[model samples]
Target: MKKLFIAALLFVGMVSFAQDAAQPVKQQRERLTPEQRNEKHLKKLTTELNLDTNQQAQVAKLLADRSAKAQKHMEMRKARKDSSIKPTAEEKAALKKEIMDEKTATEAQMKSILNAEQYKKWTAMRDENKEKMKDKMKERKNKL
Candidate 1:
């Protein structure tokens, strides 16, 4: 009985170590190229929306563009972080305005691409996701 227990523990430990060794650790926000990001978003949207091929192609282009723009913005933010100087009030306001304008433009493009029902469903999903993010942030804040 003692030998059996010891062997089982050894097997469990070995399996656990093998699993750990099989996984590659990555950075918290390890960078992916825009094309890679676009592919991921395309797969997600297709699964969610049941997009036709034409719609998928159009959405892919939009997603690629959005991903590139996002990467650019991320680079800018990183640059700002690395610098000692904080952005001016005007700069902050400008950044916010830019983000809002892009969001509106993207929505318009999406509406044009999607059928009426899909657009409505997409909006609902986006809002739900926003709410979930807010809740997550609140929970994180409470934890701190």
Candidate 2:
């Protein structure tokens, strides 16, 4: 009876460890970095849109530039959060305007990179991706 109890405990512990190990691997795969996402988007565009060399180069550069700007904006927001200081209403409005303006500029750049037909397709793909991401996030929240 004593030997059997020890064996059962060992088995339980091993099963617990195996379960814990698998979770982190699954979570890591789900958590994508901004750079990784940008690269994936570029690859998708190339494959789906059948971009030529010049178009690919232009799109790649546009994506990289937009990604860098977005990272900078995110860092600024993090810094603001870490400071434990709240902005005034006017300041908040100004910041919102700035972000919107930046988005407008980025959209213009995308327009310059893509022709009319490609832009329409690109916009559709972007909307579909946003919906897919929303669904994924909802599922993740329910799991938590």
Candidate 3:
């Protein structure tokens, strides 16, 4: 009986070590360059909206501009985060207002660029993505 118990303990230890050894390593993914990302996004939009050459050029330019602005915003945000300073209520309100303004401007630009049907489809896609983001945030909150 003592011999059997010792063998069972040894088996459990080996199984635990085997499970740990079999676990997969997480790999770091290569990120695309900004230009490459922009081009890929443009191609997707072209395919989805059936954009003409002229529209494609315009959209590409628009995307590049938007990307630049977003990059700048991200840098500023990172700097603020690094500073470790909490924003005041008024500052938070101002930042929220600025984001809303940018959002409205982008929507207006999209409406100008796309035809009625394309704009409608684009809005639908945007809303769907927004919902997905909200769901993801909720899931993260729940997890935490």
Candidate 4:
């Protein structure tokens, strides 16, 4: 009787451990890198806005440009992270302004590719995705 009881307890414990292990795997699968997020947003926009081939090509170019700029900014920031070397407020502001300008340019180019109605839908989709990304990041931070 004791042997059977022990076996049952062990089986239950194993099942619970398996379930705990599975949860994080599921969560990790849902997590997106910056590139993945961009691709997903583009895909959603394309589907919802019914982009033509020309629009799709233009959007792709915009995405590539944005990604390159973002990567460069990240690299620059990483290079500036030495404890003894800090950016001045002016320098930081300048960098931020540059990034914002690049973003505005990209958005303008995208707008040119899309019709007014499509642009509106695209903007709405982009806003919704920004919120979703914020929520996902919050969830990841909570997990950490």
Go through the candidates in order and give each one's C-alpha lDDT.
Answer: 0.74, 0.71, 0.73, 0.69
lDDT of model 2 at position 140: 47
Name the runs in model 4 displaced over 4 angstroms. 1-27, 30-41, 82-84, 133-144
Tell me the tens digit of each residue's lDDT in model 2 across 33-137: 767877897899999887888988888887777777767766776688899888889998997898778767867887888888888888898789768756755
Alpha-carbon runs more than 4 Å astray in model 1: 1-33
TM-score of 2: 0.68
Candidate 3 residue-wise lDDT at 34: 68
Candidate 3 Cα errors over 4 Å, as ranges: 1-27
lDDT of 3 by residue, 82-112 (tens): 9998888998889778777877887898889
Q: Please, what are the lDDT tens digits per residue for candidate 4 over residues 102-124?
A: 76887788789999999898789
Runs in model 2 deviating more than 4 A are 1-25, 30-36, 137-144
Residue-wise C-alpha lDDT for candidate 1, range 55-141, written one tens digit per residue: 999999888777677767767866897986799999999988988888898999999999998898889988997787567556645
lDDT assessment of candidate 1: 0.74
**Count of steric clashes across candidates, in order:** 0, 0, 0, 0
Which candidate leads in lDDT?
1
Ten contiguous residues with the weakest lDDT in model 3: 1-10
Model 2's number of clashes is 0
Model 2: pairs clashing at backbone N, Cα or C within 3 Å = none
- Best-to-worst order by TM-score is 3, 1, 2, 4
